[model samples]
Each structure stands twice: as C-alpha cells, then as structure tokens.
Target: MTLLAGARVFDPETGETTRADVRLDGERIAEVGPGLDGDQRVDCSGGLLIPGLIDCHVHVAFRRPEPLPRSARILEAVPVLRGLLARGITTVRDAWGADAGFKHALAQGWISGPDLLVSLRQLGPTGGLGDTWDPAAGAVDNYGDPSLPDPLFDGPDAARAAVRRMVRAGADWIKVGASGSMRAVRAGVDVRPTDAELAAVVDEAGRCGRDVLAHAHTSAAVVSAARAGARSIEHGTFLEDDAVAALANAWYVPTLSPMSDTEFAGTHRRSLRLAVEAGVRIAAGSDLAPRPHVDLTTELRLLAAVLGDAAALKAATSEAARLLRLDGDRGRIESGLRADLVLLDGTDLDVTDLPGRVRAVWHDGERAGALTSP
Candidate 1:
C-alpha cells in the first residue's frame, strides 16, 4: 500500500482540481482524499497528479530505415513498452504489429511493459499500403514472410477471411487500411475499399465481438469507414464539413495530430477545427513510429498548438481512453480507477510547454524515478 499526498489532482471527468491524497493498494487505486493513510507514503508537495495517459494509435513494433523482421520486431516490445510507461503512458492501443502474443505476454506479466492492446497486422486489399513486396531485395520471397506479412485481401470474402485469421491469431481488435496512405503508399494513387468490402469487414468484426479501427486519410474513405461502423478513424486528414458532421453523429474518433507538422496541415488543420466544433470526439495519438523522438508529451504539445489547451488535454487523457474503451479502468485520477499517474513539476506551466515539464512519472502506483529535472 502506498499514499501520494499534497498533490493537485486533475480529474478530467468532473473537470475538478483539488489538493488531495491518493491511496494505492497493489495495482489499483484504493482511496482518494485530503490526507489518506497507507503503509508507505510519498510526498508530492510540488507536483500535479493526473491519470496515466493512453495512446489510442501506436505501432509498437515499428522501426526506422527498414522494416525489421517479425522476430526482431517482437523482441523490441519489451523496450518499447518500458519507454511508453516511463513517459507516463500506462495503456496503449497498438494499431499494427506482428502478432497478439506480444500483447498477451505483457498483460500476463510475462513481459516487461505497460498493458498492451494490439490489433495484429492491419488488413487491406491486394497491392495496398501494407502489402509491399520488394522482389529486388530478396527479403519477402514467400507468403507470410516474417519480414513482409501481406496485409491484403482480394474482395469481401477475402476481407472476412482476413478478419477471422486475425481473430484466431489472438487480435483484440481489427485494423483495416480503408484507404491508401501518403507515407506508406507510393506509385499507386490513393484508393479506398469498396462499400461492400468495408461492410463485410465491419460485419465480420462485429460477429466476432471485436471492434474495427480504420486507417482513413481521405474524406470519402473517412465517411465510408464511419458509415460502415468502424470504431475509430485513425487519420481523418482530409475530412470535409459534412464528413465532420457525420463523424460527430457516429461518435467517430478524429485523430489529427499526425498531420499537425506536415505540409498538408494548411488544409487538414481547418478540417480538424471544424470536426471539433461539430462535436466529433477527438483523440490524441502520435502515431509514434519511424521516429523515436515523438513521445506522448510531444504529441500532446503539438495537439495543443493545433487545437486549444483544454481540448489537447482532454484528447490526451479522457478522450483517448474513451476511444480505446478503457475509460472505466483508466484515463483519470479518481477513487475507483487504477493508480497509474504522472506528477508534473508546475501548476502554472503553459499546456503548450508540457513536453518539457514532465518531472516524474508513476505506473501502477509506483514512481518511475527515471525523469530528470527540466
């Protein structure tokens, strides 16, 4: 048992801020009050305690320069999970990875990382963004190649088959590339899956009691995915006004931070603003991959710059947890939630400057003890 006292607790759910003490028993929050008592105590006299952050979209096995082999990618999960926890992210939803066993390992305490929620390798059509075979490299010469597992389907039947395969492989959710990606697709112009195919994937996912997350970049694709019942739209980069309204009606997640620094931000930012104004739920995700420096704090700061401070904070914490469907268990500092929290150094610090103000972090009621003074 442990007690964290004298901290300004930020409760996103109630929009409440107060000096409080939080008690932790084992891995859960035992109590919260002004002067809680416990077997062990820690002073948080100059800190602010908020819920552990959740990253709705992430690629844990992602590596730079060249894609790593399946075995190597799986092995990197330990360090990646540790890094995320050290940054105060106790939960993460991996958008794509080699397999679900990696996530199961973390959850069963067989691995060293935060609780992982994985959508094993994204599903798409033939010649889609996830189905690249470089014959010249001699790396992906066979089907189910560890280096290049084809994330492709031929049609609706194929799409349904792919969903079953993913479920059988222990996927918690299904990730489908409904449209071509600017960074992942080259030569082939951007194309979206047919309505029939989208419907089939969604239906199959529903039958299996799993949610579908769509990687949609264009307006048409976003609309199609939302209408087809996708749980979240990974990157609604080119959303239109009407599409934003539809997203709000469907309660879709409009993930916008990936394009916050891109050249397309000139147009995408406006769409994002409209989406927010239309009451569509916004979630924070760094899509942190191919670049190691992009952490949750950096993503939150970028979001604040694009949106406002309040929206950014909500996106990073409460909204993101909602998207991941973990709001009941995490995402806020409350009496009956997990004791995963982060302690920042200042109360008067600008929200835009959050990345530099992370003084300490705690996961599962234990201090991270890794962060140094800013």
Candidate 2:
C-alpha cells in the first residue's frame, strides 16, 4: 500500500479540484480523501495530481530517424515507451502504424510503456493518403515520409472485407480515410473514398463490436463520416459549423500539431471554437509521429490556447479516455481505478509549462523512477 499525501487531486469526472491523500493498493486506487491510511507515504504537499494522460492518436510503428530492421525498430521503441511512461502518459491509442504485437509485448511486461490500442492498418483508396505511391510518378512515394501500411479498398464490399481482415489481425479499432490528405498521390482529389465505402467500414466494424475513426479533413467528409456512424473524426481541420451538428455526439480529435503550420491552421482554430460552441466533443491528439525523445506535451499546449486550463486538461485525460473506451478503467482519480497518475508543479500551472512541471509519474500504482527523463 502507498499513500500520496496532501496533494490536490483534479477530478476529471466532475471537473472539480480537491486536496486529498490518494491511497493505492495493488494496482488500483484504494481511497481518496484527506486522511487515508497506508503502509507507505510520499510527500505531495503542494503538488497537483491528475489521472495519467492519454494520447488519443499516435503512430508508434512509423519510421524513425532511419528505417532499420523490425527488431531495431522495436528496440528503438523501448526508450520511446519509457519516455512516455515517465512523462505520465499511461495509455495511448495508435490511430495507425501499430499492430497488436506491440500491445501484447507491452502487456507481457517485455516493453515498459503505456497501454497501447492499435488500429492495425489504415484503410484508404488505392492512391490515397495511406498509399503515397503515385503511378504517374513511376512507382515513387512522392511524399517521402513515414506512414502506416496501406490496405487499399475500392468498393463497399472491399471496404467491409478490409475491416474484417484488420479485426482478424487483432485490431482493437479501425481507421478509414474519408478525405484526401496532404500525401495523397492523386492530384485534385479531396474526398478519398465514396460515402458508401466509408459507411461500409463503419458497419463492418460495428458488426465486430469495434469502432471506426474517420481521417477526415474537409467539412463534407466530416459530416458524411458522422452521418455514417464514425466514432471519431481525426483531424477535422476544415470542419464547419454545420459539421459540428453532425458530430454532436461523436468525438473530434483535431490533430493540431500537423496542421499548426499549414494554411488551414487558422481555419482549424476557428473550427475548434465553433465546435466547442456547438457542443462537439473535442479530444486532444498530437498526430506527432515519434522522434527520439520528443516532448509529448506539444498538443496539450496548443489545445490549451483554445480550451481553458481545466477543459484542456480533461481533453487529454478523461475526454480522450472516454473516446478510446478506457474511461471506466483509468481516466479519473477515483477509487477502484488504475493508479496511473502524474505529479505536476502547481494546482494552477500553465499548460505550456507542463514539461518542466512534470516532476514525477506513476504507472499501475507505482512510480516509474528508473524511466525518468533526464
């Protein structure tokens, strides 16, 4: 048993802040109150504790500084995993570029990292975003960048088959492209697949008891994907006011990092504000591919500018967990939930200052001291 004494706890469920001693037993939180009895104690007198952060969209299987062997990539992922653990991100949802192999490895305690939920592979049109190959460019990948494996599909039948194939591969979720992307091989293409194909992917995922996240950028695609029952819209950078209506109950993970420099960044900011005003669910996702020891707080800082402190914090924690279906297990600082928590500098710290304020991290009720970032 361990006692985290005298720290202010932020309740993501109620968006309330209270000071308490959080007691941990085994892997769960045993109690949260002013005076919790425990065998071990840690002084958290003036620090702030919240549920461990969750990155709703990450690409754990993408290329690193250089493409190495599979074993080398796995080795490279070790420190990356450790960094995430030490930084207090206890769970991550790989939108693409990851497989069940990583999940199983992490589960078996072979690699120390956040609990990973993978999408296996991403689905798109033949020459769409996932497949950066351009026939006109003679088999060249014009994008010259790292992307998840592409499972291209043509029709509704093919879309359903692709989803089943991924589900069979132990995918926890599915991602379907609804709009053309920056790396789309085809010129002048905005929407990638037909609406029927997008809906077919959703229908098949539903049949398998899984949810599909739509990689949508345009308002048309966002609206279409929401209507087609997409669980979430990834990078809805161009989503309009009416699109928010369609996504009233669905989640919108605007991967702001990738778009912060593009021409649509302003539009994305406006869209986010509109979405918030229109009752669209906003969850934080960086869409920042792994670069050795990169800061995980990038998106949170960007999100905080649009959302106030508490809303931004919840966006990265409880809101993201709810979207990823892990809220019931670990997103709140409540009893019976996993004791994945973080200790920050102050109760009213700024988001941009979080990297320095991340004084300590806990995973599964214990401090990951050895994995602390230098």
Candidate 3:
C-alpha cells in the first residue's frame, strides 16, 4: 500500500479539486480523502495530483522526413512508450503503426510500456494518402513496405477484407482513412472514401466487435464518417459550423493542437473554435509521430492556448478517456481505478509555464522521476 498525502486532487469528471490524500493498493487506487492509511507514504505537499494523461492519437513507428530503418523503429518503441510514461501518460490509443506482434510483446511484459490499445494499420482506398503510389508523380511502391504499411484497399470488398485482416491480427480497434491528409503523401487530393466504402469499413469493424477511428480533414468527409458511425474523427481539421453541428451528438477528436505551429493555424483555429462552441465532444490527441517522445503537457498547453486551461486539462484526462472508452478504468482520481497519476510542482495550470511545472510522474501507483528539458 502507498499513500500520497497533502496534495490537491483534480477530478474533472466531478469538477472537484481539493487538498486530499490518495491511497493505493498494488496498481489500483484504494481510497481518496483528507487522510488515508498506508504502509508507505509519499509527501506530495505543495503539489497537484491528477489522473495520468492520455494521448488518443499516436503513431509509434512513424519517422519524420524519412522513415527510420526497420530495426531502429522497432527498438524505438520501448523508449517512446517509456517517454510517455515518464510524462505521466499511462494510456495511449495508438492510431496507427503498431502490429499484432508489437502489441503482444507489450502485453506479455516483453516491453515496458503504457497500456496500449492499437488500431493495427490504417485502412484506406487505393491512391489515398495512406496508399504507397503517387498518382500525380507516377511513383509506385508496395503497400506492405516497412516504411508505409498502412493497409490500402481498392473498394468495398477490399475494405471489408482489410478490416477482417486487422481483426485476425488481434487489433483492439480499426482505423479508416476517410479523407485526405496534409502531412502524408498526395497532400491536397480529396481522398474521401465513397459512402458505401465508409459503411463497409464500419460494418466490418462492428461485425468484429470493434470501434473505428476515421482520419478526416475536410468538413464533408468528417460529417460523412460521423454519419457512417465512426467512433471518432481523428483530425477534423477543417470542421465548419455546419459540420460541428452535425457532430453535436457524437464524439469528435480534433488533432489540431499539435499542428497549431504549422502554416495552417489560421484556418484551423476558426474551425476548431466553432466546433468547441457547437458542443462537439472534444478530446485531446497529440498526433505525436516520429518524435521518439510523446508529450501530453505540450499538447495540453497548445489546447489551452486555443481553448482554456480547464478545457485543456479536461480534454487530456476525463474527456479523452471517455472518447477512448477507458473512463471507468482510468481518467479520474477515484477509488477502484488504476492509480496512474501525475504530480506537478506548481499550483497554477498555466499553459505557458507547464514545461517548468511537471516535476514528477506516477504510473500504476509507481513513481517515475522528473521530466527532462526538451
């Protein structure tokens, strides 16, 4: 048993932030109150304790500019996960790049990492951004290349087959590319899958008892994917007022915070503000690919710049967990949930000052030391 005392516990779900003690038994939180008894006690005086952060979108094997060597990419996964753990991210929904073997390795204790929920490889139509061939440039490559292995499909039948392949490969969820991507190859093409194709992927995933996360950038594509029953929209970078209204009753994850530093910030900021005002369930996702380290606080800081500090924290903790369907098991400083928590050194949740405040991190009731400067 362990006790974390004299800290302000932030529970976003209940809107409670009070000075309290949290007791842990093994990997789960045993109790939370003013004072708790435990065999071991840690002084958390003058600190803030909250649920461990969650990054809803990440690509573990991705490398920027050029793909890394296969062996290097594989070896990097452990340290990447460790970086996330060190930053107080105990759970991550790997949107792409994790294969069945990699996930199994993490699950079997062969790799020390977060609780990984992966959507095998992203599924997309031929000539799509996820596809290997560049139609305009007349360049061609195999879809299964180590550098770009996100499965490509040609039609409804192929989409169904690809989803089944992912399920057979032991995927926890399905990822479908419903629209074009600005960062991937074929940047400006409208790669939205046909409505029938979108339905086929969703149906196939439903048959396998899994939810689908759709990668969408355009307003039309976002609405189509939402209507097709996609569990979440990965980017929603161009969401408009009408599009936001369309997703008012559904879950949408805007991965725009990380891209705020890019050239597209002006256009994306207006769209994001509309989406937030429309009450579309906003969740935090770093879209942290190829960085070797996943930084939720950085993502949160960007979110606070766009939204506010309270909304940014909610997006990372409770809101993101709800979108990932892990709210019950994590995401709150409550009893019976996993004791994955983060202890910041300061009282103010200031976005500009977050880098200096992340003093320590805790994962599954075990303390990990301070975060290194970037």
Candidate 4:
C-alpha cells in the first residue's frame, strides 16, 4: 500500500479542488480523503493530483512519407509510445495503423507505452482514405505493416465483412470513413461510403460488442454517421447547426492540431464553437502523424481557447475517458477507480502547459514515469 500525501485533488467534473491524501492499494485507489493511512507515504506537498490524461485518437504507427520498411516503421514508433507516457498520457486509443501486437508488447512489459485500445485499421470506400489501390500502376500500396489488413470495401455486405475482419484482427473499436477528405470534396471527387454501408458497419461492430468511430468532416456526413449509430464523429470540421442536432447522443472529437494552419482553420474553430454552444460532448485529439511528434497538449490548449481552462482540462482527462468508454475504470481521482494519476509540481489548478509541469505519473498504482525537471 502507498499513500500520496498533501496534494490537492482537482475534480474535473465540478472544477473544484480538495486537499486530500490518496491511498493506493495494488492497482486501484483505495481511498481519497484527508490524512489517509498507508505503509509508505510519498510527499506530495505543493502538488496537484489529477486523473491521468487520455488521448482519444492517435496513430502511433502512422506511415511516414519516407517509405521505410515495416519493421523500421514500427521501431520508429517505440520512442513515440514512451514519449506519450512521459507526457502524462496513461491511456490512448489508436485510430489506425497500430496492431494488436503493440498492445500485447506493452502488456507483457516488452515495451513501455500508454494502455492501448487499438482499431488496427480503418475501413472506407474504394477511393477513400484507407484504400491504397493505384489505378495508374495497376497495383495496391502494400507499404503499410502487414498486421493491418486491407481496409477497402464497396457495398453494405463488404462493409460488414470489413468490420468483422478488423474484429478478428483484434480491434477494440471499428473506425469507418463516413466522408471523403475536404480537399477531395472541394475537388469534386468526393466518394463517401453509402448510408447502408455505414449502417452495416455499425451493426456488425455492435454485434461484436464494439462501438464505431466515424471519420466525418462535413455536416451531411456527420448527420448520416450519427443516424447510422456511430458513437463518435472524428473530425466535424464543417459542422453546422443541423449536424449538431444529429449528434445529440454522440461524441465529437475535433482534431484541431492538424488543421491549425489550413485555410479552413477559422471554419473549424467556428464548428467547435457551434458544438460547444449546442452542448455536444467534445474530446480533444491531436491527429498527429508519426514524423512531427505525438502531443495532446496542443489540442488541449486549442480546446482551452474555446472552453475555459478547467473544462479544457476535462476534455483530455475525464471527458476523454468517457468517450473511450473508460469512465468507470480510470477517469476521475475517485475512490475505487484505477490509480491512473498525474502529480503536477504546482499546487494551483492551471492546466495550461500541463505537460511541462508533470512531476510524476502513476498508472495502475505503479510509478510509471517522471520528469527530471518541473
């Protein structure tokens, strides 16, 4: 048993802070109150204890432009996995390109990484995002890791088969392309999966006890995906009022980092404001490829620009867990929950530049990572 003493716990839900000592037993939080007793007490004075951060969308094994071998590509992501945990992210949901082997390696202590919930690959229409067919060369792009199966389909039956294939490949959730890229739509080459196909994918994933994450950027796509029973919309970039109404029972993950410099930056900001005003549950995702870096703080800071600091913090912590269906297991700093917590050096609750202030991290009641400086 261990006790984290003297830190003030910040509740993401109510935006309240309470001075308490959190007791840890094995892998769960045993108690949260004043002066909790434990065999060993770790000094946490002048610190703030909050739930460990979660990133709802990440592609750790994303293919880079340089075209490396499959083993080299996967090895390149090892440091990224370690970096994510060092930045205080205890859990992550890989949208695509990471297979079940990555998760197993982490569990078996062969690699250090955030607890992973992997989609393995994303399904889409023939000419959509996951399709690698090259008509000019009459060959498919097989540069990606073989662990990720082909992700192309045409009709509803093919879509259902694609979902089943992913489940068999060890997908925790099914990700489908509900719409084409913005550039494709602007170029008048949009080719989204049919409504029937989207519904069939959702139904098949549901039969496997999994939820669906729909990659949608347009308002029409958002409505269609929500109506098709998608649990979350990936990039609601062009979200409108009617689309917000369609997401009454769904989540919205606006991956703002990748769109910060695009021409549609202002439009994406407006969509986020609309979703916020409409009371939509919003989660922050970086949508970063492997080259630059895996940083969720940028997304959280962007969210802070729309939502206040406290609420923005919640978007990455408690709210992100809720989006991943892990609220009861490891979201808040409550008793009887997994002891996935981050201890910040400062006593105050300013989440701006959160990663810089990380002093130590605990995942499942064990000291996972710590910074050399605060």
Candidate 5:
C-alpha cells in the first residue's frame, strides 16, 4: 500500500479542487480522503493531483525521415514511447502506424510506454492521404512493414471489406481518411469519401463493436461524416455553421498544434469557438507524430487559448477518457479505479500548465521513471 499525502486533487468533472490524500493498493486506488494511512507514505505537500494526461491522437511508430530497415524502425520508436511517458502522458490513442505488438509489450512489462489504444492503419480511397501511390514512379511507397494493413479501396463494398481487415489486424478503433490533407495536398480537402462509402465503413465497424474516427477538415466532410455516424471528427479545420449543426450528436477533435502558425490557424480557432458555443464535446489531440520536434504541451496551451484553462484541462483528462470509453477504469481521482495519476509540483498553477509542472507520475500503481519538462 502507498499513500500520497497532502495534495490538492483536481476534480475534472466539477472543475473544483480539494486537499486530500489518496491511497493505492496494488493496481487500484483504495481510498481518497483526508488523512489516509498506508504501509508506505510519500509526502506530496503543496502539489496538485490530477488524472494522468491522455493524448487522443498520436502516431507512435512513425518511420524516420531517412530509410531504415524494418527492425531498425521498430527499435527507434522505443525512445519516443518512453519520452511520452516521461512527460506525464499515461495513455495514448495511436491514430495509426502503431501495431498490436506495441500494446502487448506494454501490457507484459517488456517495454516502457503509455497504455495504448491503437488504430493500426488508416483507411481511405486510392490517391488519398493513405494511398501513397506515385503515378510517375509506377509504384506505391513502402511503409517498411507489411504486417500493417494497406488502407486503400474504391467503392462501398471495398470499404466494408477494409473494416473487416482492420478488425482482423487487431484494430481497437477504425480510422478513415474522410477528407483530404490540409498540408500535403491542399486540393484533397475538396475530396472526401462519398456518403455511401462513409456509411458502409461505419456500419461494418459497428458490427465488429468498434467505433469509427473520421479524419475530417472541411465542412462537407464534417457534415458527411456526422450523418454517416462517425464517433468523432479528427480535425474540423474548416468547420462552418452548417457543420456545427451537423455535429450536434458527435464529438470534435480540433488538432491545432501543427496549424498554430499556418494561414488557416485563425479559421480553425474560430471554428472551435463556434463548436464550444454550440455545446459540442471537444477533446484534445495533438495529431502529433512521435518525433523529436513535436510537443503535446504546445497543443494543450493552444486549446487553453480558445476554451479557457479548466475546459482545456478537461479536454485532455476526463473528456478524452469519455471519448475513448475508458472513463470507468481511469480518468478520475476516485476510489475503485485504476491508479493512473500525475503529481505536479505546485497547488496554485492553472490546469492548462499541467504538462510543464509534472513532478512525478504513476501508471497502474507503479511510479514511472525520471520526470522531464514537456
């Protein structure tokens, strides 16, 4: 048993803070209240206690810029995984690229990494973002590993089949490129999956008990995806009034870090404001590839700019866990839940400053390694 003493606990659900002591037994929280007793006591005076941060979109196994062997590529991803844990991200939803092996390794304690909800690969039509076909070269770009699915198809029938393939490949969630890329191909945003195709993908994934996450950045794509019953829209970059109305029943994940300085930054920021005003559930996602240059802290700071500090903190904690359907097992500082928690150095810091203030972290009741600024 371990007791964390004298810390202010932040309740994500109520946006309130209270001083309490939390006791851990094995892999679960035994109790939470004032003056808890345990075999091991750790002083946590003048600190903040919050649920471990969860990143909804990350590509943990993204390959290096230069060519490398398949074995080397997998090996190189280890440091990035460790880096995420060190910076206080206890859970991550891999948008694509990470395979089931990574999750299994973490479960068995073979490697150090955040708990993973992997999508395996992204599905889309030919010539879209997931296609990677070069007509001039007469070949497709190799992703270095053949174990992952090839996410390209043409019609509704193929779309249904692709969902089954992803399920067989061990996908926890199905990721589809509903709209075009905003960076690589500006023309791609104008192109998205047809309504029929999108519906088929959602239907098949539903039958397999998996939710579909649509990569949408344009108004047309957002409306189409919402109508087709996608669980969430990945990046509503060009969301409009019509799109907001269409998303009345869905969640929005505005990945703003990569576009923070781009020309379209203000447009998406405005879209976020509209989404908030319309009562849309907003979740935080960096849409970040696990690389040396990316930062999840920057993503949280940007979200704070639009949704205030408390709301932005909820976007990454309680709200993100709800979006991933893991709120029951984690995401709160209550008893009878998994002991996934983060400790910050101060009690008076704003919730948005969590990543930078992390002093220690605990994953599944075990304290992780040395901490670092995000």
Candidate 6:
C-alpha cells in the first residue's frame, strides 16, 4: 500500500489534468481523490503524477554487438530495462527477437523490468525487411540468434502456418513486415508481402484472438495492411493522401528515430503532421536501439514538437495501450486500473525532460525504478 499526495495527475483518456492524491492497494489503484487516506504516504507536493508510459515497439533481446559478448548483451540489458522504468515507462511491447521465456521472467520477478508484452519473433518472407542476412555475416538474426523467426512463405497456407507457430509459442502479438527494408533490399520499399499473404497472417491472428501489427513504410504497403485488418502500421512513414484514409481505422506508429536519416528527416516530419491532421490515429514508439542507445524521452520530445503536449503524452500512454490492446487493464490513473504510476519532480509535465525528472515509479503497487530523492 502506498499513497502519492498532492500531484497533478493527468487523465490520458480526457486529456485533462487535476490535482489529487492517488492511493494504491496491493497491485491496483485503490482511490484517487483530493483527500485520500492511506497507510503509507509520500509527499509529492508539487510533482506530476501520470500513468506509466507504454512503448508499442522495442527489441529487448536484440542490439548492436560490440565490446560485449552475445551473452553479455543479454545480461547487460538490465540497466536499459531499468533505464526504461526510471524514465517512467512501465510497459513495453517487444516488437521482435524476444521469447516467451523472457516475458515470463519479467512477470515472475526473475528480472527487474517493465511488464513485457512480447511478439516472440517477427515473421517475414525470405530476403525481406526482417531478414538477418548480412553479406558478411551469413544468417544471423539480430546478432547471431538463429532462433528468431524468418520463415519464407510463398503461399497463404505458409503464412497461416507461420502465424500459428508464433501463437503457439506464446506470442502476444504477430509482427509482420509488410514492406521491405531500404538498406537491406535492392528493391527498397517495393519489397512487400503480397496482399494474400497479409490476409492469411491477419486471418490466423484474428482466429486466435490476437492482433497483427505490420511494419509498413510505403503508402501501398500501409493500404494493403490496413485492408488486411492489421491492428496498426508500425512505421507508416510514407503515407499518401489516400493512404492516410486507410489508417483512419488503424493506429499509425511512426517510429521517429530510425527513419530520421538523410532522405527522410524533413518529409517524415511533415508526413507525421499530415497523418494527424488527416484524422489518422497516431501512437508513439521509439524504435530506439535497446542496449547502448536506449532512450524513450527523445521520441516523446520529438512527438510533442509535431503533435503538441497533450496528444504527445497520449501517444506514449493511453493510446499506445490501445494499439497494444491493453486499454482495459492499464494505461490510466483511474481508481480500479493497475497501479503503474510515474511521479515526476520537475517544473511541469513536459515531454523532453519528463524522462529525467522522474522522481519515483510504482509497478504493480510495488516501488520500482530510480528514486533520486527520498
């Protein structure tokens, strides 16, 4: 049981904030009102209390390998995991390269990290966006993990089989590369799964009561995925005018970090604003590297620059939960929701410095993350 007193709590659902005290009991929020009484109280007098953030895309078990051995990279991901929580991210949806074993470890207290929603491994065709084939390094999936799924399927039957494989492996979501990688493929963005293949994957996922998220960059790919019933387009960077309408019913997670390269910086920024103005549902995902370059704050900061403060906050919090199909369980500071909270000691609840200003964090009503000051 814990009490966070006198803070500005932002309601992601309403985009309104108010001053109140939040009381937690066991693992759920007990109450949220002005004069809530509790057994243990922490005076967050001038702080900002917000629902714990959710990152819709991350690759926890994969990162650039240098200086550290393969196993060290896995073990050393602890700090980055802690860094995520300290920065107020309490839940993460691992895009790929994470297995069910790792998710169970986070749930069972074997690891100190956020509540993990893992996709196990991304399913894609041969020589596609998720292909781990480096000319120099033969067939290494994200630094020599052969267990990662890169099944090549030419028919709808094969695609359905791949989706079932992931579902049987305890995947929470089925991640598919609907478009090709610019750097990896000679055909560039034109490399995409056929509409039939996308339909098969989506069909299998729907039958299992799981959602499918597509890594789509081009407008054509985005349109195809949305038509095929993917829950969201992971990197809908090049959405056209008509493509924007396609995403009206689907969430668009424009992972701003990776696509900020030379050819995309200005246009990608413009497309983000267009997506918003065109009534497309936008969610936040830092496609940031996991180990050496873990940072969720920059994504929010950049998102705020494009979508203003309140919407930017929603991109990271409640809206992200909706994209991950976790709206009912968490992603709010309500009385009955899971008590995943982040208390900030800062000037205000701004996106840029909100990560650094995290005063304390609570996951499942238990104190977690870095408490900079008592």
Best by lDDT: 4
The runs of at least 3 residues in candidate 5 whose Cα sits more than 4 Å from the true structure, single-residue gaps closed, are 349-355, 371-374
Instruction: Rank the candidate models, highest lDDT first.
Output: 4, 5, 2, 6, 3, 1
Q: Write the per-residue lDDT of candidate 2 for residues 1-374, one digit (tens) a residue.
A: 99999889998757778989999998899999998888999989879998999988887666555645556655656777777777778888887766677888898988788888888677887766666565566554422323233367899999998888888878889988888775442255664788888889999999999999988888888898899999999988777767889998699998888777778789888889889888788888877474543344878888888987788889888899899888888889989999999999788647786767887888998787645543
Give per-residue CA lDDT, model 1, range 225-269, as digits (tens). 888898888777778875786685344444455666678776766
Q: lDDT tens string, model 5, 1-374? A: 99999999988888788999999998899999997899999899989898888888888887666767777667766777787887778899889888888998888888897899988888988766677777686555567465588788789999999898889988999999888787644754345678999999999999999999989888888999998999889889989999999898888989898788789899989999999999999988888763454656677889989887768878888999999999898888899988998899888637555557888899999999974332
For each predicted model, how many residue pairs clash, with residues at least 3 apart or on different chains?
A: 0, 0, 0, 0, 1, 0
Instruction: Rate residue 326 of model 4 by lDDT.
Output: 93
Cα lDDT of candidate 3 equals: 0.77
Q: Which wins on TM-score, candidate 2 or candidate 6?
A: 6
Strongest candidate by TM-score: 4
TM-score winner between 1 and 5, please give it.
5
In candidate 5, position 265 carries an lDDT of: 96
Q: In candidate 5, where is summed lDDT lowest over 10 consecutive residues?
A: 183-192
Per-residue alpha-carbon lDDT of model 4 for 254-286, expressed as tens digits? 998888888999999999999999999988777
Candidate 6, 160: how far from true, in Å?
0.7
Better of 2 and 6 by lDDT: 2
lDDT by residue for model 6 (233-314), tens: 8877777887788888899998887766557767778878889999788888887563345456777887888888788888
Order of models, best TM-score first = 4, 5, 6, 2, 3, 1
lDDT of every predicted structure (CA atoms):
0.73, 0.80, 0.77, 0.86, 0.85, 0.79
What lDDT score is found at residue 78 in candidate 1?
67
